[model samples]
Target: MTVTVVVGNPKPASRTSTAATLVAKGLRPEAEPTVIDLVDFGAGLLGWGDPAVAAAARTVAESELVVFASPTFKATYTGLLKLFLEQFDGGTGLAGVLAVPVMLGAGPAHALAPDLLLKPVLVELGATTALPGLYLSDRTFADDGVIEGYSDRWRPVVRALTDAAKVADHA
Candidate 1:
């Protein structure tokens, strides 16, 4: 399976990026994961006519599974992330791809934003969304689901995504 991960965090070395990388690190070898830092696309994304944007969309089109990661900002993901996603035109944006959403926030209050926002967009693009969006707080993001005394208790999410990714039946 060709797995592609889109890092939507605008900040350099953001916690959300780190967490998404960690998940990619654990991908099964057969998947051949590819990580694309959306920042690399730059200002060209503002206009759909850029060739670079089309290239990025092509990469997304070829992947069997995709992981969309972004830090929860102002209750949703960053505008840059949305801009990058918008460049995906027609069937190339999604079709035949399964999307896993990973989001990080300073607090648990914005935990549901991943599903509320990312999933719908992915669906609109023609991708099948994986169940149980993963949400991690900045603190204890590597620990037992507890960030500095707060427990998000979101383990099933990771398990479900990993299990779903195994559905790579590319022929």
Candidate 2:
């Protein structure tokens, strides 16, 4: 399966990116995900039609599963992520892709940010979010079993959905 991890952290190679990569690996250990760290795009996200940004959007759109992750900024996702998301063709850009929203926060105060805030945007962009969004503590995401636990519970479901989506796409 084509799995991708899109990190919206303002800092390139931040902890958020590492957590996101771990989440992707937990979901599909065999798949090597294409990691898109939005900070690398820099000014390219300000306007439309940049080749690299467009290519990144296309890569996400074509993936079977994508983990859209960001650090909780001001109790919501970072604007960098929003800028990248804006490249899509609203409602159809992400059609047929399965998305998993992930957010990292310093504490549990904004634990619901992933589902309450990010998931809706992914849905609006036409990605299917069958599983609940994942919220990880930026402080302890690596040592914590949260990603592994989530993967253990939802991996089979993800596999089923991706298989079905592939069939539907072919049909």
Candidate 3:
């Protein structure tokens, strides 16, 4: 089973990335993971027709589960993620794929941003979204730039993702 994550955090060392890393690490051994950082691709995002972008999109298309991650920008997912997702032009969307939306922000007020904003987009992409999109407070989860320090509330969320992955495997 393949599970991939498309991360939109701009910094090389970012909390958003860390959160995704944590999720990837938790996947079942049989569930191989592909974690792609959009910033690492650079410049020709619109040149998505390039071999690399095409390859990455294929990874996304083939994965049984996808963690679509981003550092909340203006209360929504980053443009970097938007660019990467634009590469899925085959009109397949994310059909037959399960998605876990993740968003990190400076304040707790934006906790609902993932569910309210990102989830809809993931659905439009044709992916079945796991409930309660993960949201981490930059202040609480990113101390000294370390995202490994998950908040007390993050446990159940992790379990939810794990459960979803199992369900997707069966489906």
Candidate 4:
């Protein structure tokens, strides 16, 4: 299956990106994920019809699984993520795609940001969120087993959802 990672961190190769990649790998080890760091899109994100940005959106839309990640800002997801998400159509833009929202923060205060804020947007874009959103501590994510544990519990659920979506398509 095709898995895609979309990082909304402003920094090109930020820790958020790394965590997102790791999450994608943990979810489906065999899949070589397509990592799209929005920073690479540069100023194109501000305008419309940019080939690279459109390609990235298409890649995510076509993927079987996708990790939409960003660092928590003011207790919410970054505006950068919002900009990228706005590229997709309001409904059915991500049809048949399974999305996992991930957010990293300095403290635990905004741990619910992913579920409360990001997940809704993904749902509105027509993606199925089969499991709880993941929240990681920006300071300790690398050494923590959060991703592993989450994968253990939800990977199967993700697989099931994917299978169900496929079946629905054929029916």
Candidate 5:
């Protein structure tokens, strides 16, 4: 399966990226996900029709599964991520892709950010979000078993949905 992880953190190689990668791997150990760190895009995200940004959006659109992750900023996702997401055609750009929203916060106060904010945007972009969004503590995501726990519970479901999406694409 083609899996991709899109990190909206403004910092390059931030914990948000690492946690997102971990989540992608936990869901599919055999698949190597393409990681898109939005900070790398820099000014490219400001306007439309940047080749690299467009390419990134295409990569995400073609993926079977994608994990959209960001640090909790203002109790929501970053504007950088929103910029990247804006490259897509509304309601069709992400059709047939399965998306998992992930958010990292310093504490549990914004635990619902992933589902409440990120997931809806992905859905509006036409991605199927079958599983609940994942919220990880930025402080202890690596040391904690939250990623593993989420993977253990939802891996099979994700796989099944991916299979279905693939079939629909062919049909």
Candidate 6:
């Protein structure tokens, strides 16, 4: 499967990015996901038709599965992510893709941010979200079993959906 991990953490190589990569790896051990650290894109995300930003968005849209990760900021996803997502067309841009929204927070208060905030945007962009969004605590994200447990329960379903979507697309 073609898998991608898109991180919206303001800092390069932040815990949010690491957790998202771990989740993708856990979901498919043999697959090395295309990791897009939006911080690297920087100012490119601010305008329309920026080649680099457009290419990255295209890669995410073309992937069968994508893990969209962000550190909770002001109780929601970062504006940086918002800038990137704005490039896609609502309700169609992410068609045939399955998205997993991941959020890392300092505390449990914003644990639902993944599902409540990010997933809706992915859905609006036409990405199928078949599993519950994952919320990881930043403190223990590296050693915690959250990624594995989530993959164990949801990976099979996601794979099935991804395959089915591909078949449907070709038909």
Candidate 2 residue 63 C-alpha distance from true site, Å: 0.5
List, residue by residue over 1-171, the lDDT tens digit for candidate 4: 889999999998999999999999998888989999999888999989999999999999999999999999988899899999999998899988999999999999998899999999999999988779999999899888999999888888887887787888889
Q: TM-score of every model?
A: 0.78, 0.98, 0.78, 0.96, 0.98, 0.97
Per residue, candidate 1 scores C-alpha lDDT tens digits across 1-171 of 577888888776667666676655444335556777778777887886788778877888777667789988889988878998887655546876767777888888998988888888888888877555677876668774333222123334434554565555432
Query: lDDT of all predictions, in order shown?
Result: 0.71, 0.94, 0.73, 0.92, 0.95, 0.91
Candidate 5, residue 20: lDDT: 97
Q: Which residue ranges in model 1 land beyond 4 Å of their true spot?
A: 27-32, 90-92, 145-171
**Which digits, one per residue and each the tens of the lDDT, describe model 6 over residues 87-118?**
99999999988899999998999988999999
Q: Going through the candidates in order, what is the number of backbone clashes in each?
A: 0, 0, 1, 0, 0, 0
lDDT winner, 4 or 6: 4
lDDT tens readout by residue for model 2, 54-110: 999999999999999999999999999999999987899899899999999999999
Q: Which stretches of candidate 2 lie over 4 Å from their true place?
A: none
RMSD of each: 4.6, 0.7, 4.3, 1.0, 0.7, 0.9
Query: For model 1, what is the C-alpha lDDT against the true structure?
Result: 0.71
- Which regions in candidate 4 have their CA more than 4 angstroms from the true location? none
**Candidate that scores best on lDDT:** 5
Tens digits of per-residue lDDT, candidate 5, 133-160, equal 9999999999889999999999999989
lDDT of 3 by residue, 16-77 (tens): 77777665555433555688888888886767467777788888888777788899898789
**The CA-based lDDT of model 4 is what?**
0.92
